[model samples]
Target: MPDKITIGGVSVDTRHWIGGQRVASAETFSDSSPIDGGTLGEIARGGPAEADAAVAAARDAFPAWAATPRAERARILHAIADGVEKRIEDLAIVETTDNGALLRSHRRGVMPRVAHNFRFFADWLLSLEHEDFDTRGHRNHVSWDPAGPCVLITPWNAPLMLATWKVAPALAAGNTVVLKPAEWSPLTASLLADIAAAAGLPAGVLNVVQGYGAEIGDALTSHPDVRRISFTGSVPTAKHIAASAAANLTPLSLELGGKSPLLVFADADLDLAVDLAVEQYDNAGQVCLAATRILVEDTIAEEFTRRFVDKATTLRQGDPRDEATDIGPNIHARQLEKIDGFVQRALEAGARAVTGGHRGDGQYYAPTLLTDVAQDSEIVQEEVFGPVLTLQTFTTEDEAVALANGTRFGLAATLATGDPERAERVTARLVAGTVWVNCFFVRDLQAPFGGSRLSGVGREGGTWSFDFYCDLKNTVTAPNGFTDHG
Candidate 1:
């Protein structure tokens, strides 16, 4: 890697994108890369005033943006996709450098999806069917219209992708957005503003504000002008947003964290199960939907634990830039210490580490597994958000289901079993937004993504997202031949 990552042969923007321009402020914060603890750049410090300006701009632009023809909106989204495709490498580098995600994974796995999100929503918009019904006494037409100015707050991990997941559909539905990216991972989001502008996104249609949440989160989420708020982060933060949004009776879509379970049945393919478990270490297990809980059938638990521990020990941890590196450092020193705390506490509580345990050098924690953990313990019930996996055994499928749903979160769950009938049955019983049968983290763009209970309030992707971003209205008309005979 070089001294600094650049985009378009220039130093990347680290300021807020508000009112169709990059706004720099004297008050700023240092953005550091997790790779080597180097300062990446300084980002603008935005507070209530900045958020107000962005919301005002979006509110001003909403009428015209909302009225823009579906075809025209689709065309602009396609252009944005094209712009992203052309600069895939530049954007990918920014994401990896700022967020410490693996460059190899992002370039190949995430960049394409960035463009695809726009395309997917754009196409979905054009193909949507406006409901029209003809009856003997009256005619009725139901249509979806933009919900007006909205707030989109994204988290640090997978900032670009998660923001895109909300922004694409919101824009496609013609809702102007004031996006506040997590302060730690603001570079790539800043680049997206340039891409959108280059693609002809009208001024004030998409605004980005970067700062600490405490500085701007309340003002953004509670603003009367913002009709909707979509957030992806911790459950505690979501609750705060919920209370603030309620001040305006604003609709909110919250995708919170999870302690998701990956069930390994007695009849599961052991090799495949091991492979999936290892893959969960991607992003150092910072992902909200990762399989943090490894619940295996009692009959096969011992064998599975041995294989899993051996495989985890082999995973290389180093600088993410290295193609051979399997696990990168946590986002920051604080996260590393947090992971260490969880592991230490579990060990002290009598849970045994199967293989790798303890924190390594410089924000790196070895992939850890803890067996003999109680079902109700903090290690098993809480979201560690690290590469630490808690192992638990279940004697029956009922027990597996109970253990999986024991946590406050119900974001997602995965099960590996040979019997299709049993898979579907268990899937139905699990109270989660998404369920995977014999697979891990498999997503379909058209399928709804979210959680039940505290995982999230509303679904995203496909029609569900469109519904959230748009307000539905029904128009009732008099019969064709009937005039207004007041």
Candidate 2:
């Protein structure tokens, strides 16, 4: 491999990292930047052969790495965190250029959080307490065992942060990793692999295989040696992976799509509600946890609509590298077309676009809010995953709960109200795995995080993350007085 390759006017090193070395693929795919639809460069396109090699490398290194002391593993993790912080500016630029998210958001939030994911998991590993029980003069000790090779399939929207969300836990639990990054946002994962190796991570402990998910995902998921799988994507993709892993009985932790709701009560703080409403336009409305379905109490619906439309229309959309840009272009032309289709169909069906409704220059899409929408319109019920919000008015608490829980998805929901009793009441009735009252995306690393219904399969955070990454084994010691001889 060359010392560096030119990508969109920047010299960067992005290649498949296998067995602690950079390996190029026989075939390549063009990765286009959404900023101007310019060709970034030809990315390494891995197939079954590359997938097999990565799995082999991870398998070969698992035994020694798993047996390594936890303290040493944690030290290396902190070192990785250090490397991430040192290169925060570089990673933020690459990620913004690769995925079209605002560079300011990445530098201020995403990159810093990426470092936090590593350091938090590392410290948590050290502070963990194993379960110990003594019953009837017998001792029962529960321990965590590394589950061998793991396959981590991450999404494109927030590439490095989400990949490390799984990578950090899997490595801390002593499992070797084979990461399959989204084709659209593959750059930062390669950077992470380099960071890990520089942090004294042993060879083959972490490998990256990049390509289209359709070709490479099957081989990685179906591989017999892979003991664990953690995926974050659409529900249909999760079902396909489940079938592939079923033969090997490989456990999976799937974090799927969402059509989350944000219920605005009549008594809610109007400014707070409108601010939260405008935040859906952040990242071009690509976040899965975004509450795109807005269920508002009819009493304050008129004033709420006016404030929401004003703020959303003013959101800046331009070059992601600009600090002033609040919203960036959609990830690609394909995504932009999809966002348009959803908004257009809704308008044609008598729904009114309160703010934005058309595609802007190039891949940029105008932030949109739709009112007078049918409760069961395809746009209302489906996951558009774009900068479009649907409005529905309800008068009663029961109607709000029903409207929020009416969809098939239950990933997350938001409630804005001052009454603590009502917040608790509505929160209890919302079926989403995570319910945010008076805020959005406020997270604690230790909290149980995942989706309900079609949103996802298993919880991942705190011990839940370790539970998926490691095998829990319970040891029971027999009482000395009643030891039986076989």
Candidate 3:
């Protein structure tokens, strides 16, 4: 389009990356920076044509790429990781300017993990060995064959990190990928496409088509040629994608919404508990695993609420580019309004805002903590997806578990307790995919990750990732070396 736009001092190209080339769209949309609601640049507005083209390219590339040696694929993945490490600063700045996440966190934590996503998957792939066993005089060999063309859809929050989380595993499993990033922050995905190309990825192995879901989602997810789909977003959209994918019965993995809880036991460390509770405000509470609903034991509920409010109020909200700022603005004006509405409605329903309950200048909203909330109210049961926390009191271990599992969402939960036995006892019973004991937001990439019930449909991490990206085939041979023992 127009020469090249400088975003946060880094040059950016805003075109769809398909078949290892930059392709322009018939129409374009102006992208904005949430920092000050300023126009960043014109991004290609892709439609069905682009989506079809990307899938076709992926389909065309799958055979040769899948046939390539695993070691060579691993080498290419390492190269991609190297490219990501080299451009961390530029990637972090462009992501922050576009999505309104804290720049410092991006530079320090998010970007590094983005690189590790590729490295870890590559190393994990190289170490894996499919087992072959004998069954009644026959040998059964287990193999994970690469599935064909696939589609990956990621959300706006933590765009690159999450996209690469899916992309790394899919690519490592030898599947061709057509990544459709969220419309809100699509720039970095374009950058990543270029990185993969520079890292010696074959044409059409990795493609990016950026557009609004309404315009391009159906085309990508509903394509009959798409063998697998991985999506991370809201429940409604997940349902939409599922419906479309069901036509071809295409296998899909969904990582969806949550109204998770952080339970604090009376015997827990007060400092650790308060710190974990306040961390729900990080990323402006845009995280799907955020423990927005807090259940504190009756004995320490008052004190915990007081400390949580004080810490939450201390969070510095401002421009995302500022190193000193703890939280940045909401990604869009509508998101700001939606966040405030949740607080306002809670206030109207007799919930008390102990710290913050209003909006700041531009797209920034105050980190809010609500108390005296009704357990059955929408504020406690629904995912606000904002810088808001709701507190309730629980008298015993059973009550705490009940409150933690109260919502339909079983995405994640945090339990704070001094007793190891209780941590084991209660964490086992909590209805969630992930449980954090005496901690919050500590992630180990090798562990299984996803939600139960409404939060999501499947898990993805380590072997779980490969399981989803590849198909299992068992080869049985009669009279093999070890099969003589019946």
Candidate 4:
């Protein structure tokens, strides 16, 4: 709600964060509150020109930033983390208002995780290793180098967190970035730019742009100066970015969609299973790794469904700002419509709505649970991305694994079982980037986060994130003799 958001110690004139400054163009878009459909503010609608300016700024900053020592760069990132910690309440307010995430969750769960991610990556930057390899009289050494200019495209669901997954690492790895935040929720992204600017990141090193994907995203993807693209969004967009990057052979890292499943075994704790199911659906199942499908062992399927439905039915569905509310609205009206269409299609295809299957308004869809969902049904296969949970029964472990891995997405899977051996075995067999044994939806910054197959291309968190943002340069030194010109 500030008149002008500050970034890099500079007060930008525009509402939206773009080109490393506040940007106000003739074109503008209104940011609306999903909870009550209230207008938040009008943000600048950046197109190709803004995208070009952002990319140019990043290109200009890359040389000097990349040349800066790792320790100094790490210090800047650390300062950003400190700023985030200081303004946690303000950032949380903006994020919750814009994205419809629970205020408590944004403050306690999401913001803390983001802070940890930045700090963890900052530590990794200080400890990064470049080894000297000596192989049979060949003195070879390898050093990590920045990837130059990077284009970061983030989604609207977790606007700030997901964007930081790319921005923090790219910046810490010494690559200047042009960040294109999803237009629907640009508040946190803009606020982040303000925080980064206040933390003393060089102007061009971190830039934010707002616009439709076709214009700004296309420009960022096709720009000759951008050496890498890191995106977190739907599979279709990922495919587009991947293809565009392929044309120029620019390196890319994508964390796409997922229809992740949770397998509950006969020996599992039913209470705990129900608890996790409710928790995973807390953000209305908008999270990428949300346990949308639950494949339970036949012996416990009936009881699990009975209890799960009861717990889900008890969830409070209303405004995100309400402390008593357990679930909130979807990010937008179109998202609610999309979710409704999926639910209706599933019902038409003989799926039984075990519980809620209705929409309250343009943004709020009732927390829903569907049973008897066909294996090939769109609701089961595609990413509904709403508070809709589908159930299927499996007789054996093999069947459970098959059902869990049935979808093209392999983002995450959860196994709830008391048997340690079975948990380990099922964890290995489940084809997902992150597997939760006896739990679901829990993660740490130290853990490497990403998915496999159509889920994504590269890891996002931990030390491995540097791999996506930096390239390796190998050098060889002769003991005393000369080197070959070739």
Provide TM-scores for the models. 0.96, 0.97, 0.98, 0.95
Q: How does model 3 score by TM-score?
A: 0.98
> Residue by residue across 1-486, what tens digits does model 2's lDDT show?
353556545466657999999888888887888999997777888999999999999999999999988999999999999999998988888889899999998899999999999998998888776868898878999888999999999999999999999999999999999999999888888889888889899999999989987788999999999999999998999999999999999999999999999999988999999999888878899999999999899999999998987787778889999888889989988888888998999999999988889889999988888988888899998998788898999999999999999989999999999899999999999999899999999988899999999999999998889988999998888777565787
**Local error of candidate 3 at residue 161 (angstroms):** 0.2
Model 4 C-alpha lDDT versus the unseen true structure: 0.84
Checking candidate 4 for backbone clashes, the offending pairs are 6-194, 7-197, 8-197, 9-197
- Each prediction's RMSD over C-alphas, in Å, is 2.4, 2.0, 2.3, 3.2
Which residue pairs show backbone clashes in model 2? none
Candidate 3 backbone overlaps, count: 0
| Residue range 86-121, candidate 1, lDDT tens digits | 988888877888888888988898989999999999
Query: Comparing 1 and 3 by lDDT, which wins?
Result: 3
Per-residue error at 209 for model 4, in Å? 0.6
Error of 3 at 41 (Å): 1.1
- Deviation from native of the Cα of residue 423 in model 1, angstroms: 0.6
Expressed as tens digits, the lDDT of each residue in 1-486 for candidate 4 is: 345543323333345454456666668777788888888766777888888888888889899999999899989999999988988777777788888999888888789777766787888898888667787777888777998999999999988888887888899899998888898887777778888889999888888888788877888898888999989999999988887788789998888899999889889899998887777786878989999998888888889988988888778888788888888889998899899999999999898988888887658888888998888889999998998989899998899988999988999998888899998888888889999887776777667888998999888676678877889878887775686789
lDDT of 2 at 153: 99
Candidate 3 least-lDDT 10 residues: 477-486
Off by over 4 Å in 1: 1-10, 134-136, 481-486
